[model samples]
Target: MDQGQLVRILLSLILVVGMILAAAWAARRGGLLRQSQTRRIRILDSQRLGARATLALVQVDDREILIGVTPQQISLLHAGAAPRDDDDFRSHLDQARSS
Candidate 1:
């Protein structure tokens, strides 16, 4: 192809990529791309025990669940009412660990 044609194609590609990036930036600034404020389920915390194993504290509705996650399956360690504070969560975690 001619040098002029090649330059035109390159400019067109750059312009398209620039437009995509600008649209993403504007959406993020406008909060259109962010996660919603009101979600029913939330992961309170998690700890990685091994390469493929994780212990996660998840809150759903008004209850909290301690779950063990692995590649094979997810197991519920404990399920109880949501804790009021971080300290309460820690105590629950300690109790779960001991059991």
Candidate 2:
């Protein structure tokens, strides 16, 4: 192909790439691609057991779950009520001292 045809192709490719990047930027700015502010499930901690295995502590609402994860599947090791915040412990201590 001629120099003129090569330049046209390069410009078209650049324009298409720029349009895609701009669309992604616009979606992020408009919050269309953002995760929700209020998430019910959260990963509290995680530990790698081996090459393909992982132990994860997850909090879902008021429950704390211990899960074992591997390439094949995820299994629940244990599930219990979530621990109370440090503030709750402090408050209880203060009440006991006053009583």
Candidate 3:
């Protein structure tokens, strides 16, 4: 095979791998969001769900939760969080940040 063809093949493989990884990551996040959303709805109900306009930072057991609510609805969602402990939290964060 020519050098150009070999390089093209390699680049194509890399691109494909990158795309696969991206899609997998996205799917993972979507799954997590659905699970959390489902849990909130089941446990808390729409009445407890907060509005997007009113949001407050609520921390619990190391994990930070963003509680947003309006007069009609309430929801407990994730915004951004820091590690709880140096060991367990770090490992969890590493896995999350990886895949």
Candidate 4:
């Protein structure tokens, strides 16, 4: 291709990339792809066990649970009520943050 044609191709590529970035920014800014408001369950912590396995601490409503997960199955390891005291919950949160 000629030098003029090469310049046009490069400009087009740059414009395309800039447009994609702008679109992504706009979507995020407008909260078009934000997390669901109705989603109740949240993962408090997670650790990888193997290539396709993980252990996760999940919080649902006022309950906390530890679950073992694999590609083929998910198993509940433990379940307990969340701490009711503010001080205890804060300490637990601090411990989790430190880890």
Candidate 3 has its poorest 10 consecutive residues by lDDT at 38-47
Residue 16, model 1: Cα distance from true site in angstroms: 1.2
Sequence-dependent TM-score of model 1: 0.67
Most lDDT-accurate candidate: 2
Top-down lDDT ranking: 2, 1, 4, 3
Taking the tens digit of each residue's C-alpha lDDT, what string does model 4 give over 1-99? Answer: 999999999999999999999999999999997998666899999999899999999989778999999988999999996668998889999999999
Candidate 3 residues lying further than 4 Å off, grouped into runs, are 32-99
Question: What is candidate 3's TM-score against the reference?
Answer: 0.33
Error of 4 at 6 (Å): 1.6
lDDT of 3 by residue, 27-52 (tens): 89888435553232222222332333
Please list the residue runs of candidate 2 whose C-alpha ends up more than 4 Å from where it truly belongs after superposition: 70-75, 82-99
lDDT at 86, model 4: 90
Q: Cα deviation of 56 in candidate 4 (Å)?
A: 2.2
The lDDT, on a scale of 0 to 1, for candidate 3 is 0.67
For 1-99, candidate 2 gives per-residue lDDT tens digits of 999999999999999999999999999999999999689999999999999999999999879999999999999999996778999989999999999
Each candidate's lDDT (Cα)?
0.95, 0.96, 0.67, 0.93
Clashing pairs in 1: none
